[model samples]
Target chain A: MAEPLFDRLALIGIGLIGSSLAQVARREGLVREIAISTRSEKTLERARELGLGDVYTLDPAEAVADADLVVLCIPVGACEATMQTIADSLKPGAILTDVGSVKMSVIDQIAPHVPDTVHFIPGHPIAGTEHSGPDAGFPDLFQNRWCILTPDKSTSRDAIDRLTAFWRGCGSDVDTMEPGRHDLVLAITSHLPQLISYNIVGTADDLETVTKSEVIKYSAGGFRDFTRLAASDPTMWRDVCLHNKDAILEMLARFSEDLSAMQRAIRWGDAGALFDLFSRTRSIRKSIIEAGQETPAPDFGRPHKKGRD
Target chain B: MAEPLFDRLALIGIGLIGSSLAQVARREGLVREIAISTRSEKTLERARELGLGDVYTLDPAEAVADADLVVLCIPVGACEATMQTIADSLKPGAILTDVGSVKMSVIDQIAPHVPDTVHFIPGHPIAGTEHSGPDAGFPDLFQNRWCILTPDKSTSRDAIDRLTAFWRGCGSDVDTMEPGRHDLVLAITSHLPQLISYNIVGTADDLETVTKSEVIKYSAGGFRDFTRLAASDPTMWRDVCLHNKDAILEMLARFSEDLSAMQRAIRWGDAGALFDLFSRTRSIRKSIIEAGQETPAPDFGRPHKKGRD
Candidate 1:
C-alpha cells in the first residue's frame, strides 16, 4: 500500500463509480478515511453492508465537512442540486471533482455553486461494467482505463495535478480536455451507441410479427451483443441522455442520416456499397484491438462455462 | 467416438462454417471422408493447408460427385449458381443442406435445381464468431448453440432426422421451423442487429465533429460492443441483406420508427420513457442468459489479458 494522498476522501452518491472508487482507494491506500453519502437510504445501507467506506451518512453536507478530497459520483443531471447541498461545507483548499459522463452540462450546472476556497475539477473515468450499484464495484474497474478531467483555465494547476495523481493511484491513465470537447467525444463514443442499442432492443421487443421468445432464442446470431449495453442502469443512462442533450442529438442526426444511406443501399441491392462500408469498419475494430481498447478473442472472449466455442 | 453417419460428406464452400464442419466432423468421427471445395482457389488452398478436409477439389461438382451428404456453406446469394453447378453431379438419394442465415431465400434459390431423388433440407446454426474464412473456423464453433432447420411437409422425415443428428453431433440443440417464419425471426434477432451495428460504426467513422482517436480511446464507454458485429465478413453480410431483403426492410422500418420515438423522448427530456425502456431491456439480457444464449458476465465477461478491466 502507498501513503495516503488525502486526510479524508468523501464520495457522494455511492453507486457503481462511487463504490468502485471506495474499493480502489481503500485497496491502494489513497485516502486515510473514506466517507460515503447518498440521497437514497437503501443504497447507503448497501454501501455500508459492503464495507465500502469508513463513514456512512445520508447527509451530503456532513460527508464533505472535513474531507480534503470530495468526489461526486452521481447522475449528471443531479450535479447542480448535489453541489448546492454540499458546497458551503467543503473543506477550505479541498479538491472537488466528479465522475459524471457529461462534462459540459456538469460544469455548467455545478461550477457556479462551488466556493472559491475549494477547487472544483470535473472528471469522468471512462470505465464501467453493465452492472451497477455497490455490489458491482470491483477494485480493478479503473485499471488501465482512462480518467479524463475537464478543468477550465480558472482552475488551479495544483488542484489538477493532485486529482491526476489520485486517478493514477487508482490505476487509471489520466488525460485532460475541455469540457465541451469531452462532451462531444463521449456523445459519439458512449451516449449515441447506448441510445441506439436501447432503441433497437425496444424495436425488437415491440414487434408484432416476431415473437419475443424467438428473438431471445436466436439472439446468439447477433442480438445478444446489443443487450449488454441495453442492460445498463436505467437511471444512469436516462440522466446521460438528459444532460448531454445537444451532443447526443447532433450525433443522432448524423447516425440517422447514415442509416438512411445504408437503408437505400439495401433497397437498391448495392452490394458494393454495403461490402465497402462493412470491410472498412472491420479495420476499425482491428485498430481498436491493436490499441488495447478491446479484447482480441472471439465472442468477446466469454469464458468456457459449459463448453468450448 | 460416434459411428460414422455418412460414408462421405461434401462441403461446397470451405469458409468459416464449412471449415468448422470439416474440423468437427473429423474430430467426432461423424464422416468417414471429408471433401472440401470452394469457388476461390486461394480459400481451397488455405483449407488444405489447415488439413480441414481429406479430399480437396476446385470443382463443387467434383466435390459432390460420390458424396452421401452435401452441405452448401456459401453466401445465401450464391446458393442458386452453386446449386446449378452441382445439381447434375449430386449422388442419388443424397441429403443436401445449407448453413445460410436466410432460409426461405435459400430454399427458393436452390430447391428447383435439386433432383427429386435427393432430399433438400435447409439449415442455419444460430452460432458464429464475427471472424470468417478457413482460419477463423474451429472444431467447437457450434458447441451448446442452437441449429434451426426449416423443412416443409414435402421434406422427408428421415432426412430431417439425419440432419438433426448431424447438428447434435456438432454439440448443438436442433429445432425446426417453417422457412418463412425462420426468415422473420432471424430478421429481428440477427440481421437487424448486424445492420444497425454496421450503420453505427459507419456513422462514427464519418463524424467530423468527433475525432476518430477519441472514439477508439473511449470505446469502452459502450461503442466497442457493436464493433464486434460490425467486423463480420462483408461478403457474407452483403448476401444476407440481398437474400433477406423483405424481412430486413420490414425490421429496419420498425427500428427507424422506434428510434424516432426515442429521439423525441430525449429531445423532450422524457426521462421516464428512457428509464422504462432501459429497465425493460435489462430483463431481456437476463432472460437470454437464463436461456443459455449468452454469458452471465459483466462487460461480456471479457477475459483479462495484459492488464485489468
Candidate 2:
C-alpha cells in the first residue's frame, strides 16, 4: 500500500492516542513497522499482549533507535523528559511529531532536543473518547477527525508532506497552522471546555444542598453531558492545563465575565438579555452539525428503549 | 388492555414535551382522546399535520373544556396567563398539571388561578434532546427516563397515583418530591449545566482570536458537547432561567467559585490539585452511567466510519 510511508514508526507512549495510532497505522499500512514504548512496564506488556506493534520496549531511546518516524504519544508534561531521553537516539533523517492537545508548549519542550537533520512537527488530532489506555483505542479513532500539524518555517516541506500523508492514511484530514495560533485556538475549543466540565462536575460533587445521589439520578437533564468530558484521562488533561496556561486562563476569564453578566441578567429578570444569548448560541451548534463535526441525532443518539406500541 | 387512565387528555402546548406526551399517551392507550392547544397557529397546524392529537385548537379554554386531565405544557413564563384563560373551562375533578422545568415558580404562578375542584400537580419529565417543536418528538422520548412529579400535600393521593400511572405507561420511571426541593435539585442537575453550556458557546462565538469557521471545524475535541445543551429551545430555557432564578443563581455562584479556584490552581501550575480534581470527577460519570442515567458508549456512541481492516 503505497510503499508504506515510513520504514519504522516509534510511539513513545501506549495510552489511548498511542495505541490508536499504532492500530490505525498498521491497519492502513501507513508504516512498515510499529515500535511501542511506555514508562510503565505493565503498559508495555499490555501493548505486547494486544499485539499492537512489531516491537515493544520500556526504553524510549531503545524504541526510537533506527526508527524513521518517532511520535511522542505521552502526556504533554512528559514530553520534555521523553525528548531528552530519546534525542540522541533519533535517526538523523527521522520525522518527529506528537499528538498533544496544546501545541506551543509541546514545541517548546521538544524542539531544543530535536537534531538538526531530524524534522520536528507538532500535531494534535481533535479526536478521542472519554476512555483511555491501550484497550480503549480502536483503529477508527482518527476516522473523519482533524489532525492539525504545526511545523516551524525551517522544517522541510517534504517532511511535513510525508507526515500529512501518514495522518491521511490513518483516516484523518490534515491542516497546518502556526503553533502559537494552534495553542490559542485549541485553548478555547478544547482546553476551556474541558476545564469548565471538570469544574462543574466538581461543584456538583461538593454541593450540600443537593445530594450526589440526586445529581446522578437527574443528570439526564444536562449534567451528564459535562461528565463525559470530565471523565477524560486525568494525566492528559492536567498536562493540558499546566502547559496551555496563558490561553486557557484568558478563555476562563472571558467565560467567567460572561457568566457573571448572565447571573446579573438572571437576577434582574432580564428575559431579553438571556433570550438573546441563548438564541445566538443555537446557530453555532447548527454550524457545527452542518460542518460534519457532530452527529445530528437527538441526545447524541443515546439508545432509547423501544416503546411497546 | 386496561382501561385508559383519562377520558380526555388536554395538552395546552404543542412543543417538545407536549408533542411527546401526545404521541406516547396515544401509543400506550393512556388516554382515550387527546386535545392539543398552542398560541401559535403555525405550531398548531404543524401538530395537526403530524396528527399529534385527536383535537387541535389555538384556544386553550376550548381545548381544556370537559377534559379529565389538563396539562399545561407551555413554557413556564406562559403558565400564569394560560392557567387564567383555561381555569373556568376545566372539568371538575380533573387532574390539572404541568411539565415545566421550574416547579416552584410554576406552582407560584398557577396555584392562585387553579380551581379548588381540580387537582394541580407539577411534573418535569427529565428527558429531552437538543431538538424542539412538535415535529421533533417521538413516542419513545420518555422511555427509560425519569419523570418527576411535585404535588402539594393537599393534592389527593388518588389523583397523584393516576398521574403516576400515566407516566409509567409512557415508559418513564416516576418519582415524587416537594416542589421547592425539586427546584433546588434541578438547579444543580439541569439548570446550571445548561447555563454553563450556553455561556461557553457564547464565549467561543464571541472570540475574535478564533474564527467561527475554525471553532466549528475543530469542535469534536470537547466544544461540541456543550453545543448540544446550548442548542436547546431558547424560549424554554429563557423561561427556565427567569422562573428558577434563585436556585440557578445559587448554583451559578457555586460553580463560578469552584472555577476560580481551578483557575488559580492552573495559573500557579498546581499539577497535584489539577490531577486530584480530574481524577475525582471520573467516578461521578461512572456513577451516572451505572445509575442508568447515561449511556456507557464511547463518545455517546456517535457513529464512526469503519476501518478497512
Cα RMSD to the true fold for all candidates: 1.5, 1.8
State TM-scores per candidate. 0.97, 0.98
Clashing pairs in 2: none
* DockQ, candidate 1, vs. native dimer: 0.75
How many residue-pair clashes does candidate 1 contain? 0
Off by over 4 Å in 2: A307-309, B306-309
lDDT per residue for candidate 2 within B1-309, as digits (tens), equals 789999999999888889999999998999999999998989999999999999988889999997999988888999888888998998999999888999988998999998989999899999988888998888888988899999878889999999999999989999999999999999999999999999999999999989999998899989999999999999999999988888999999999899999999999999999999999999999999888888888998888775321
Across B1-309, the per-residue lDDT of candidate 1 in tens digits comes to 868999999999988899889999999999999999998889989998999988999999999999989999999989999999999999998999999999988998998898989999999999899988999888888888899998888889998998899999988999999999999999999999999999999999988888888889899888999999999999899999998999999999999988889889999999888889888888888989988888887888774322743
Give the Å error, residue A293, model 1: 0.6
Worst 10 residues of 1 chain B by lDDT: B300-309
TM-score for chain A as predicted in candidate 2: 0.97
DockQ of 2: 0.70
Give the candidate number with the greatest DockQ: 1
